[model samples]
Target: MTGSGFRERYLDVLASIYLYNEHRGYTSLDRVLDAVRQRCPDDAEFQAEIAKHRADEEKHYRMFRRWFERQGRMPLQVDSGVGHIDRFIQWVFRCSIEELDTSEIVGSEDDFERLCRVIMLTEQRGYAQVEIILKNRLIMSDPVMKRIFQIVHKDEPDHFLPYQRWLERQGRATAKWNERAADWCIHKILMLAKLPALFLDAGRPRLQRWPDEDDAITAH
Candidate 1:
């Protein structure tokens, strides 16, 4: 590929991976909300914060969808394997996001604290990555994509704050050394292994529909 071709393809894959993660983010937050409701129903403040976080994730997902729409092409299909939070949950919980036992988490204070730390680490990682992406010339070359990430960059700090505060209020450390190590490892793996693999695989399929379409259908 020429230099221009490589840049475009790299941005495309990068945005697609981000799109997938944003979708995964809100859906996983749905489960977290469930656990919060069952475990701490009286904590309206925390519940509202999580709701806002979920809404932001959905908003980011839609912006990326519109970014793809403007290009007149679907994003490349990516799965949980490319998702940072997905991998973090797997590594910490020893199960996929879908397999996470929210009930078990709600029933155990220790499990809930672990969940909060995991989310805090993931959101912090996201904020850090967005800061880097905003500085990337290829990402900044497209005005619309740059604006989308700018919005993300603004919203990201708020994403982890609530979790961190909750952990602090509980007299627990926001994150442990092991959890930080795991988060760092997950990011390196995605940057080095998964992203490069996706970039090279020109045969990768694109998503036929937006992720939110399923929710739209289910609403009917």
Candidate 2:
């Protein structure tokens, strides 16, 4: 692929980048579903929001699945650069939850805002990567790929908007001490948790970086 030239190979890198991101997203949605369903206030509005994200997740999963299916590979099993990174991200979320629990700093408006912030980060990260993926005409050249990214990208942005509103509300509200503490703990936990995955991601597409010095069957 590199023989095509550095500039030309930009498409290759861009595609690989998003493919990795997609893997993290589809996998993480299940966790998000669990968190939202189990914890979000049981109000009608909250339930509606959960349903909306659930539907969005299912649709997004199919979008990536369709594109990967066309590519003749299972995305999860394939080495999308972000897969390992995602593992670390999951770990970090776990850490955040643990921290929040121990901090005894939540159960109010601020807690909700913190939760929204965490979710918002995920959506933001996904959107940025998806934006690139959807823009890669060469990668999306396959009709299925183009359609998949389009369908998925359409509703993906919706995930972030509501959470953003939540944050705006937090800024205006004076949350209780518990809420403030919970938010602080969760925030730090999330930031700290993200490190490991990113650390491993430093070495990616090992073959791409090193080139032909690899065994095709094993690497591929």
Candidate 3:
């Protein structure tokens, strides 16, 4: 049980992050694909890429959930917490989750471009973090966790590239929008979500125990 504490904490964070992403995978990414189909009805290439992206994200969501079940635990709740990208969208757009479902958050062609910027930056952040996790010997020593990150990291670039290509097609505007979205997301993730998790135990692991146990036990 030498590293059990850290391991449990890591799994808790992992499960919560994936659960959060999965919720958005269904809610946001699927919706984004619908919007892409509506707007670029004739661009078969773009539509195909987005369809792949949506499928990958949905697959990721299921994978994470299955990982949790294998560990005999449920994902920690993230609704009030560390889902930074989703929270940032809610804060900036001033939209409720219900409103987000049906509403065209990406109004107009310009707004669509800006939405791409946000998605690209978020995916970039996700890519970097997953790379770090994969490189961490402590986390990756566990075969289950290692395999999961490997699969997720493989998909990150695919998530990023479509938005990037679309922005490149739009020319100089990408620079302005990209910087703005990246900065905003980084700020919210660091200031609003991540830093607080470190200090406040938002995704901290609870001591494992059997039902009706008198005291908690080590994670095994």
| lDDT of each candidate versus the true structure | 0.93, 0.49, 0.67
Show where candidate 1 strays beyond 4 Å.
217-220
Stronger candidate by lDDT (1 vs 2): 1
Q: Residues 86-148, candidate 1, lDDT per residue (tens digit)?
A: 899999999999899888999999999999999989999999999999999988999999999
Off by over 4 Å in 3: 101-107, 175-220
CA deviation > 4 Å runs, candidate 2 = 2-42, 76-112, 172-220
Give lDDT tens digits, candidate 2, residues 92-168: 34443223342222345444455556556656555665688677666566576677667767877777776666556
TM-score comparison, 1 vs 3, better candidate: 1
Question: Which candidate number would show the highest lDDT if scored against the true structure?
Answer: 1
Across 136-202, the per-residue lDDT of candidate 3 in tens digits comes to 8877877877888899899889887888898888683554654666456655666566745743575
Give every collision pair in model 1.
Answer: none
Candidates in order: C-alpha RMSD to true structure: 1.1, 9.7, 7.7
Model 3 lDDT-worst window of ten: 210-219
TM-score for each model: 0.97, 0.53, 0.78
